[model samples]
Target: MTTAAHPLVVRARQLATGLLGPHAERVDQEGVPASHVKALKGSGLLGVNAPTEYGGAAAPPAVARDTAEILAGACCSTWFVLTQHYTPVKLLASTELPVRERLLGPLARGELLSGIAYAHVRAFPRVPVRATPERGGWRFDGTVPWYTGWTLNDVMLLAGVSEAGEVVFAFTEAREQPGLRPTAPMRLAALSAAHTVSLELNGLWLPRDSIVLRTPQTKFAQVDRPRNTNASPAVFGVAYAALDLLEAAPEAKETAGSLRSRLDEARREAYALWDHPVPHERIEERLAWKLRAHDLLRTTTTAALVAGGGRSMALGSRAQRLAREAMFLLVQGQTAEVRQAHLGHLSEIP
Candidate 1:
């Protein structure tokens, strides 16, 4: 893994072990501070997948995933906040839009961090957020149910469905503006430190220049559907952290060894399917991998809690925190199709 890990991934591991892990418990209760964000910026870890010309590593997918595991395992709250930035970077880099020149460099250089308000686009027919064209720009109206990294992000790549059934994606400042209102961050079962919020957009207008990518809603689904079936690297990271806890507790060391062997084999198979040349191919196989990761993540984190005994009940304990995080990951990025498939597939297992 080290040989596959780029210098950026190495830097991520150092930051995670040195800083993020030490203070993860504190931040889990308090919130990911500006200092944590600053460290990410300074370390240049923020641009692992961005273009090298814009001060990024542009590293391979495995390298990116390796860094993801390190950071997410060390401090999921902070990792949650940073993960939002990558989508915008990737989208901008792929497009030749006017906004590309304006924002891609700053984002890739780690000078700017962005969040996503675009998940709502998944509710295709409902259109929680709508985009209508105007003379000056596109006007966005409606509510975004879940927007992560609220105050910490400099900008957000917001998406809305237009009348013509196109997915309208545009950039806007993360701060509250004339038509953008952010609700106070909600306390969650986990990752409350990431500052999650809901946004109301009555008339948020972004100039045409701010527009990044647009495609038919159906086409968007075509591209997005397969992406969610893969196991997230962060799942393994947290599972590994749980395994670490078990390894440290002398009684659970034997169990930890067995789980580690299974976990490694599961990860190898899952990632192989994830890297398949045709993403839409082997759909069932991918979902099976997703379930396996979730199963291991749940099992490992719960085992960690068991190893901690009564002390694990403490709100500040890493065991309890990891358990809560495991709950969050189960539904993270879940789509209706994914949900149905995951659950329906589970019932047939018996």
Candidate 2:
């Protein structure tokens, strides 16, 4: 059922348009049904960014980005669940740790799914999670405020700051274990179907081999800067979906036309900056494009909702769903600098 021309892309588009898009509303209400995840596993898109030697598609960066755009536009909850798997794959591929041999193959093959409990590390000075040297490994203690894919993941990439100010990351069983506790999944304004939870680690320990990365916290910051500055392609995808809705209505054609033109312009600029040879160049321009894209996203989604008239008020309406997703993307991968810039930009509006 797959074609030779970009098989992974072709498959992802088919899954997005068929299984994911048709069932998104129900999946959102049900918090990502099991059948949907099973379809995703068979799609082979989960391994898009992993190394080919490890059974991943090993698609190009642009291919991965386009796949994300398609999936997020179809069903963000499902996209988020799978997105967490890529980071650990990247970490394992980059690190020379012994655990790489143990986990990378299975994860890349989609035989196992992983979630991230590492965002708390971004709260640097606060030290939300801390690691102390122990006999055979390291002991982790403190709280993780946001851990998505709770019961759905097989493992998690957990991170904490060491007493010596180093960032330590390790893979651990995602289930409840001694000294590790998880709160029930949270309900949010959007993407609640992702099954997010908070984790509390009290003397949780991981063997030395399980530890994937350990470097000075400053080094992590250096690697993290360029990533946070880039615009997410999902922003463009979701905005386009709303534009599609607006385009269907005769009255909103002109508004949709103008926003579509602006969206394409900003998207090209953002993608070009993101793909530049230098990883850290033109960060300011990248952020500018990000804000511009977000503005367009807001305008398009709101217009879609307005154009839907009284029907938009229904909980299952695409216009309503897209509107809520727009809210979620506004802060999905937020950093302190991005937050400051976004808020500052809003404050300047006369």
Candidate 3:
């Protein structure tokens, strides 16, 4: 029997098709105009995963995943910016940190937009950002290699490695504050619309109350490994969009039909493994499906560009945009383990 669609999922799909898709190209060129951010804030998608007690839908995991696919397919740059908020919300909800009560209500109600500055923590062996104990709380020092949603987000969840060897995460304003300075947004190969930058934290300080989560580095990795195995929803969304483009062209219809079947197969297996009851079980199968989905994404996007011919090379073309987005997905969530596995898979090819 077919299940009824979730309301939040339906809302996300509507926003994707009606608002995000039409303006994606322009936003990519101009770097996420303010109007788009305004619309997103009003869309209520920012609170999709927030607790219902905080005026949010508290959507199911599948609802969250499905909305991601819709949003990313419509405008990846927008999707990338908004996606960062979910992690911080998840952290706050699970922790008893004081910030949870103050921020969760506002964040969940879409009163504030959030960004992330914790990816640098994934750089094991080398601590990119450092935290030292101080009077009121902790002092942060070092460079954040990448910080997205610079000008747009109201707050950020920043991370650092502490002297005690624990990973500490805290919340701070997402702008140039007393000890935090952001470089001009980087001109990236793609997703420049997200307005990414490098942040220099000379002696940034946050009160102990700002701290959200603190755990041994080992514990952090234990949690991150399984997450790294799942394929990003954006990959599936973009591949589906490209397939849609291909199907529109008479000569490419058959090619699109074949790729569609493969894409659906990969998507099903990937999501099933992703939504498993156990968080870390079937990890090997998850990675296999992730690689398979990645391959199909590459193939589907490449076919669209090929089908579009010389015109596809133009910056104004959707084919060109999707092609560049596919390239971004290749390394979007790259971890050392993922890179090693992906490379090993490539090396095995005859």
lDDT by residue (1-350, candidate 2, tens digit) is 32235778788789989899999888878888777778877788878888999999888778888888888889888888988888999999898889999999888888888999888777787799999889889999999999999888999999999888999999999999997999988999899999999999999989999999999998898788888788887888789889989999999999999999999999899989889999878888988888888888899999999999999999899999999999999998788989999998778867
Clashing pairs for predicted structure model 2, backbone only: none
Residues 213-331 of candidate 1: C-alpha lDDT, one tens digit per residue: 98999999988888788898899999999999999999999999999998998899988987799988998888888889988999999999999999999998999999998899999
* Residue 169 alpha-carbon offset, candidate 2, angstroms: 0.5
> RMSD to native for every prediction?
1.3, 1.9, 1.3
In model 1, where do residues sit more than 4 Å from their true spots? 1-5, 348-350
- C-alpha lDDT values of all predictions: 0.91, 0.88, 0.89
Q: Estimate each model's TM-score.
A: 0.97, 0.97, 0.98
Candidate 3 per-residue lDDT over residues 1-110, each given as its tens digit:
11128777787788888989998888889988777778778878888889989877788777888889998999999999989989988888898879999899888888
Residue 1 in model 1: lDDT? 40
In model 1, pairs of residues that clash are none
Q: Which candidate, 1 or 2, has the higher TM-score? A: 1
Model 2, position 153, has a per-residue lDDT of 91
